[model samples]
Target: MGAIGRFTISLRLLLALTQMAAVGLGGAVHAVTQLSRTDTTYTRVLEQEAAGMVLVTRAGLHAHNDSRLLQSLFVERDMPARQRILGERDRAQRRFRDAIARAQDVLPKETAALDDIERHFETMFDSGQRIEAALLAGEDERALRMLQEERLPAFESFRRVAQTEVARLHRRMDEISEEATRKAERAWQVTLLTAVLAVLLALFLAAWLLRRTVIAPLDAVAARMRALEAGDDRAPVPGQERADEIGRMARALESFRLAAIERRRLGHEARTDALTGLLNRRALLETLETLAGGATPLLAIAIDLDHFKQANDTHGHATGDALLRAVAQRIRAALRAGDIAGRLGGDEFVVILAGTDEAAEAVAHRLRDTLNGPVEIEGRLLRLGATLGIAALPRDAGTPAGLLEAADQALIRAKRIGRGGVGRAAARAG
Candidate 1:
């Protein structure tokens, strides 16, 4: 009776929360649907009326250009010049015809404004033919009279009527915007009013559920989960010691946290070097490409262990491997959280500094000093040094491969100055 009594009280709280969420979700969906319908109406205007207007504008411009070209043809005494103008007019006619054909899509019932445009075009075209005939027959006075009386007036009428139609389309689109805006405002108001009332009712019913032990602890748990999701894997899931529902929930959340950590560990292992536990060559290249693409400043350091093969020959492979691991440890200690290091097979390693400032240069210098330090392996003191070649992104080179090549070249240049030295890429290009 006591156990049931303790849990039975939660039913009212659960019901209130569930109902509140349902109402909120429903209202939001409804509002979005209404807004979407309104937006769709506006999109229809763009798809239909605006599209038709573009065709109309283009056809009108070409027709106007054709009229000007015809006048030029009349004035041009050279046969070649007249012929060129005629060719241009022919192209203009083709373009105008194509636009009219395509514009049938937006015209009234699939023939919007096309009939009127074609009528005006035909009238002007007939007048242009008569003018052309008069000009070809060397009747200059007759051609001038035809152009003045027929072609010019027809073109004026065509432009005026087309402008009137465009003005009508503009007015229609304005009406559509006003109508949709009104509908959207009404829908948002209705949905918002309904949602607010339902949420208020839910708050009243849920007032009893907001105790410190239950609500506070649950809120803490939710916050911890959010932190964990945001990459703070160490965020603790508290309240696991409680002998209640909260404890059980805490235990479940702890399991999820553990699973997430394990998954991340596996992901790290996949990208990591098996020997040094740094990033492998493939991961290094991938990281380099990603950083190079971003806005952040970056530097690449190419490190080669000086006399590594000689060490292997003298100390055997086991000693050489141990020495490499030792160098890797020093390299890791010298890097910041944002920096990355990778082993590119035997004796070759790379480090990526996240900054371009002298602080980054300090890290490189520190790494070189540490790597140059001697090591005692199996009671034998052996010396190893690292030669470093460095390059800055978009300064020495722009691409990942180019940066790497420049770094390598710097390494070669540094090695020329003897082991344990640093070589930098060429001076920045202005």
Candidate 2:
């Protein structure tokens, strides 16, 4: 062939080989990454299922107490523990099924291994059921024998299936790796031939193209990582407009940022009290360390409804809950925005008064006046009353635990003195 024609043919062949290598490497990377994620998810689901199965089996084996046995066996039983076990079993089954479905989607070609595992799982489940029945029928020896003979064997078979599946995954990974190596070798040979041709201009063009198309985006991603570490979100990403891999990555990062913000918002909402829109006890304690700086006074007030139990017993819990909500609103209205009010639980509530030394009597009067009005619930006029116990910051206690204890003691004294009254924390008798 003519020298020009030969050179032209060689260049075309080199380009074709390079493109094939890039495509193969991209596909291999994607497949391996996807397989790893699927395996991780599958492992988690399998572990959960195994743990739940063991728990259910234990519950069935120990169903000796007649009342408990009946409660455990009956799905509609009022026993919460039994119901929880059943719920776990159902959840485990659903997860296992979902894992199987996902494996089918991701690894459709590995059907034989998946089918083996599924068949073994079914056998194990059947054996477990038979063992439970035997135990419930008072056949202790038979149940024990079945556990050893049938259940254990079935479980071992399931384990073998798991091992087989893992082996299959490893084999597939090796095959993919070998295929990638072969592609790389072929690309390298083409690259060597191109180098021998000494076409400086073409070499420079190809190198620049590779850098812009591949290396530049990778460098940008690395810079983004450093920016993220520095808590900066303003880093520019390449290929934001192009519908390529880099563009997809930029879109993913944006999604991640939005999701992170939403998660933080949700976490804050969960820790805040719904009714009073104030930080709940858990959130208050979390921030108490920061609030309780050196020499900073942290006053704690424990508030209680004098006859809350009586109110619930008489007017029903619905009315009682409404009354509590009303009391919380009144307290929030009275306290400054800097102060924290929380419903600890039930009718008992607390307020963390930062840098306050108001007397117990004064605080009690303020709260009483705030909640003095009658609350109407379901056309019934309900009169509400509250008792307060005040413990001064840095004077009565230092730590959150100490402040809570002191306030609780003061609240007990207040209840003893009068139903709807206030008391200050006093020195405890040794």
The lDDT of model 1 is 0.73
lDDT for each candidate structure:
0.73, 0.58
Off by over 4 Å in 2: 1-242, 258-277, 359-364, 376-381, 428-430
TM per candidate: 0.42, 0.49
| Model 1: per-residue Cα lDDT at residue 292 | 74
User: How many clashes (backbone N, Cα, C below 3 Å) per candidate?
Assistant: 2, 0
Compared with the true structure, what per-residue lDDT tens digits does model 1 show for residues 308-374? 8898889887887788788889899888888889887778889887676576578778888888778
Question: Which tens-of-lDDT digit does each residue in 210-229 have in candidate 2?
Answer: 56665566567657756766
Give lDDT for model 2: 0.58
lDDT of 1 at 96: 84
What lDDT is reached at residue 339 by model 2?
Answer: 74
